[model samples]
Target: MTAPEDLALYVHWPFCVSKCPYCDFNSHVRAEVDQAAWRDALLADLRHEVALLPGRRLRSVFFGGGTPSLMPPATVAAVLDAAVAAWTPAGDLEVTLEANPSSVEAARFADLARVGVNRVSLGMQSLDDDALRFLGRAHDAREGLAALDVAQRVFPRVSFDLIYALPGQAMRAWKAELARALAFGTEHLSLYQLTIEPGTRFATEAAAGRIVIPDGDTAADLFELTRAMTAAAGLPAYETSNHARPGAESRHNLAYWRYRDYAGIGPGAHGRRGRLATTRRRKPENWLTAVSRNGHGIEREDPLDPHTRAVEALLMGLRLTEGIDLDRIARLAGGEAPVDSRAVALLERQGLLARNGAHLRVTDAGALLLDGILGAVVRAQTAVAV
Candidate 1:
């Protein structure tokens, strides 16, 4: 039998050049940063994690953040070097860095690649100038494309994000823009619908009637069109918001969806290893202070009960096209099957879920209403188990 997949590493860089109005990620903008001190702190934080979860290979390393592209290549290299030294790296270990499509950040692509970043995910939120302006992005369509060009040339694997269902966006306009984006020939795409998240500028605008997003019917149409177009382009939806060609999926993300162990290092990063869930301090200064005092900037580290792990595993795994392993869910739940058989039967009859041998999956229709389905199923299962 094949050995279990190794742990994954997530290195968070919490600094950004500018904060987007809609972003709620643990990102902050600072006029001045001490690059050396930040680098040392990240390395120190990573070492603390290594000591806790020893004797495992690393399957992937993802550099995510406020804007990881803004990170100096030297900082990235040091972290990668430290990780490899800490654990044996898989032969095809995927190292992905999240970047913004700005000209200055794009200029660092070559240097980043040279230092062992094999994949890059660009935040090219929209291909339209107006959309970029409305979304508060620094790069325009032309500049974004230029950055994408540079990324594609420098990295062996490339993925970019695009936001759809923008305020006042029409179906025809979105379809045309998506087509333009797909023509770039990148193997992976993360397409997200714009939601007025709580505490965001968009939320305030939407609440005040200053911004109007697509209605439910229009948003559904856009979602359907996205699936059809990307499938036609050979990049089918692998997750709710992510599409990729066969064999070109993001491995780092797969680790999360598949419920595998990964270490999250840096401010506001969350991670799971074995049964422990860890969260780091959210602010940069606070994280640095904690790391200096405790050797790791962890804010909380809690041991997850079996039921919680099972629920979380089911929630994450069902988001994938391949679905979850029922056997693994059972193991996580301490030998009790995690799904309510009656609910599964009902949902399967409704064509929202499917059971094929050992796997339980959400059908395409179910994916659109995944949150509701999960809530119902989890409630039913918990009730039955209790």
Candidate 2:
């Protein structure tokens, strides 16, 4: 289905059962939460934000986390209800929730599905028991599969995540995991590389040379293998780290990659509307208080320049196999993309990028070198404009 024009909503649930050592998201583990109070605060904040973007048809609503599945299903339903009440929903609008796989969560699948969440993306980071433990995941392979089974039975569409390119991972091992995951008959899959972001335990360990991750070259090779295997399985990378069968791509995520307008609600959430951008308060309690006191909890707001928007679009869109749509970029930028013709030409010669009519796409080789290519392309554009 085609995306509805120009709008989506992101509802952030910034609480988790426990924090993973490698995670650096705006999530916290707390012994208790006042669900009713939280429900009221988030609903108020969301309605206020919706007031700001009135008349926009919302195409999708994503309940992203800490661990959204941990939220009481009643609270989840309340947010979903508030979303529809606040805006117009397009045909086949998708409501998605991010959850972690565990038998406990599996039991809640039916409850979530009943509350307008027709899509469920569960975090099943690895199928190997050892890998799961190493990643500090709470579930074992059996529990993960059990949860997936429950999610598939309850939801119309189900997606699960897996992480590859771990330390000491080999091509054969990764391929085996991919094959097994595909065998689960999931319509959508997310295979991500293990990134050691600063402030994460993984990064701290790596810095002291106590932990070892795969080298850059090895990671690149594993990435290529992932693409080939997924494509062969009839699932292509519609966006970076996401693979899905035709018509199964996440609409909510597509809303982000397409650079459409979306409202972010919840602690530490970010929102963009045309050129104006806003970030919500990062602390849950503070957010609730601000919303109660002033009808909203926005902490920072600014308008981005056209060039910055274009650069963001390029950064996000190139991750898709279909690459950047020139028309969309032009419409958003209010002018043509400021890409350097010479840089694109050089990339074409290097088999890193290919021009297709009005769009520019990264080749298989280009996807392999995306980290470097993005920097080079941005610098070339800067130099050419100068």
Candidate 3:
């Protein structure tokens, strides 16, 4: 069990050079950004979070963004310095920064590494030039690879992401791409199936019949192939979309999936701290203004009830291959069982779920239909409990 004193920090950098067509994250494109103002505002925001959650041992700090690579290394350093001052850092504190594969950002890798960023998650959306263009990535395949090489050289741990099951993507091409990615010998990879998020350009295109992703059967086949190939490469699927060799799973992400406390700072960041859910102002200027006025930019702070927290914990924890601890879920639900025992027995009978003492896990086949499975189990439990 994770101790309550263990916490994670997530810092959001909301500006981007260009917004991807498929992205619905709170990211923005701006002609000019006042880096100095942003730096001060972010530091102030972090201090406010520190005051709220005092005496925690920070396990990890993740610099995520519209494009965190665009942030000046000094700003990154300042934030890290503040965090160190505010809380005790774990002996192996994992500081990860997300970067784009653009040459400009790649050039800053060494400086970023110098400033205590030990891990880099590069946004190499695709390795194929055509797919890169379709994904609205600024870097070509060659440039992306070059940036990846730079990241691997500078950062102690490097993870790159690729989007698959894209419109018109052939299974053979995807397999070849996966092979190429694995050949890089990086410890971690995040392979996501393309989804047309609502309100994004991709969603609009899909709704208008301008785009078509792989059908369900074909997508499932691609997913299975990805799992098989990654496993063969010794980087098994630790989470649904993330693959890592043993002991290489993302610590910051794991903190979230394990339903631990984390402090979120900066525009558009969402965080869970105890029973409270915190969110910051979504717009850059609005966030800055709020920070200047209130010492933090948080736009909403809602307390989650026990049942809601348990449900959320279950949803996130079940995504992992290791699955959830049923005892922990029950505790979160105020000593009530989090799932129906009969439902678990039925699912285990159906080969969709398995139990290893107190740990409850979704089978590989059940993971493909995770939403429906979770709904059924939760409904069954709630119905009987009520």
Task: Identify the leading candidate in terms of lDDT.
Answer: 3
- What lDDT would each prediction earn against the true structure? 0.92, 0.86, 0.92
Task: Give one digit per residue, the lDDT tens place, for model 3 in 1-386.
Answer: 56539999999999899999999998999999988999999999999999989989999999999999999999999999999889999999999999999899999999999999999999998999999989998999999999999998999999999999998899999999999999999999999999989999999999999999999999999999999999999999989999999999999999999999999999999999898999999999999999999999999999997888888888899889999998898788876656777878898999989899889999888778777878767733454242
Model 3 spans > 4 angstroms off: 1-4, 380-386
User: Which of 1 and 3 is the better model by lDDT?
Assistant: 3
Candidate 1 C-alpha lDDT tens digits along 1-386: 55645899999999888888888889999999899999999999999999988888899999999999999999999999999998989999999999999899999999999999999999999998998999999999999999999998999999999999998898999999999989999999999999888888888988999999989889989999999999999999999999999999999999999999999999999999899999999999999999999999999999998888988999999999899998998889886656777888899999999999878999988888888888767743445354
Q: Please identify model 1 stretches exceeding 4 Å from their true place.
A: 1-5, 380-386
TM-score for each model: 0.97, 0.95, 0.97
The predictions' CA RMSDs to the true structure, in order, are 1.4, 2.3, 1.8
For candidate 2, report its TM-score.
0.95
TM-score of 1: 0.97
Candidates, ranked, TM-score: 1, 3, 2
RMSD of 3: 1.8
Candidate 2 pairs with clashing backbones: none
- Which residue pairs in model 3 clash with each other? none
